[model samples]
Target: MKFLLVFTLVSFIISFLSDRNKTFAGTKKGLKMFLGLLPTILNVLILVSVFLYLVPKETLIKILGHNSGWLGITIAAILGSISLIPMFITYPLAAILLKSGVSYRVLSVFITTLLMVGIITLPLETKYFGIRASILRNILSFIGALIIGLVIGIFL
Candidate 1:
């Protein structure tokens, strides 16, 4: 993380030096985008926190543990589809789940669907991409996530 921060800072400095006006403009645009998404981000964080608090570890284990089999995969897929957590948070959470004995198959499906399929963001996606395209993309992504999970389960 420190390396990434230093690298990003150095890269930004170089870019700023190369073109101050463009750098400032880009930074401003990025900040604006961040601000625009801040509300949704905050909502997701709160929802995830509440969910974690309400759903005990034992319940999670029962649902997604190694012995859960295909039912767990289906549950994971549904949860991932509906969830709105960011990728950074997803990875750490995945690691925690793995440590807690969640099956690799379920985790793979959850992470894949969480990243690829966005039921919670369907409205926003439809607004930008049209309903047909959004729905088709999500369906394909869901199928792909399942296939990927199956393959991962086989290997791991």
Candidate 2:
């Protein structure tokens, strides 16, 4: 907020001092764009906080572990992928899980698959790329996320 205040002050001064009207107009446009996006940015942060509060840290950690074998991993990934919860929510949730003994690898899979394979966004994706393309991309990405998680698990 302080940084934004400083930026606003700087912009105001620049706009006021500038002789060229074009420069002032350009600055105003930039400021308007920033202001327009601020609400979405703040909303995302608030949702993250809320999700972190609502979900139990232990359960998140359990989901992070793949001790349940491939079936468990598949189930967890499928659920996570189906979840339309925003990334802002997922990251802090992952942080809590990580702090509570969850494996980073599983969390990575959850997050990667969560973002990459979106059942909720399927309508939009399908509209853009037909049903087959969307399904193929999602399947390929899901498998890729699984493999990456396993490889990271071995090292971590």
Candidate 3:
């Protein structure tokens, strides 16, 4: 994280020094991008908070924790595939689940599927990539995530 911050800072500094006008335009574009994503970010934050608050810790543990086994991984993967969560919020929420007794395997599957398999974004994906391609890509990604999760579970 520190490396990223430093790299970004240095890049921004170089960009500003080399071309002030371009730098300013880039900053404006970046701000617009942030604004565009703000609502989704806020929604994810609220959704995560509400979910954690409404669902009892014991219930969460019983469903997704170490004792929950492959069923828990399947549940998490399905939820991840269906949900439209920003990566920033999803990771922290995953970490919270980890702390709450969710197994590494479950978290691994959830996080991987959350990133790769976009069931919720199928409409947009299909519009861009064609329905067949989009569906195949999602299916492949889901399979890949499961394999990756299994490897991570074995190694870590």
What is the Å distance of residue 51 in model 2 from its true position? 10
Clashes of each: 0, 0, 0
**Best-first order by TM-score:** 3, 1, 2
lDDT tens digits, residue span 48-123, model 3? 7798889888888888877888889899889888987777567767776787777888889988998999987899
- Report the lDDT tens digits of candidate 1 across residue range 1-156: 799899989989999999999999999998998788777767766876687678887887788887788899999999998988777467766876787668899999998899899898899999999999999999999999999987998888
> Quick one: how many clashes does candidate 1 have?
0
Score residue 48 of candidate 3 by CA lDDT: 70
Candidate number that wins on TM-score, 1 or 2: 1
Q: What's the lDDT for all of these models?
A: 0.86, 0.74, 0.86
> Which runs of model 1 end up more than 4 angstroms from their true locations?
1-62
Top candidate when judged by TM-score against the true structure: 3
State which candidate, 1 or 3, has the greater TM-score.
3
- Across 1-156, the per-residue lDDT of candidate 2 in tens digits comes to 699899978877776777568767887888898688667767876876686578676665454454645654666588778988755456766776566666766677777788778888989999999999999999998888888777777787
TM-score of each model, paired residue for residue = 0.63, 0.58, 0.73
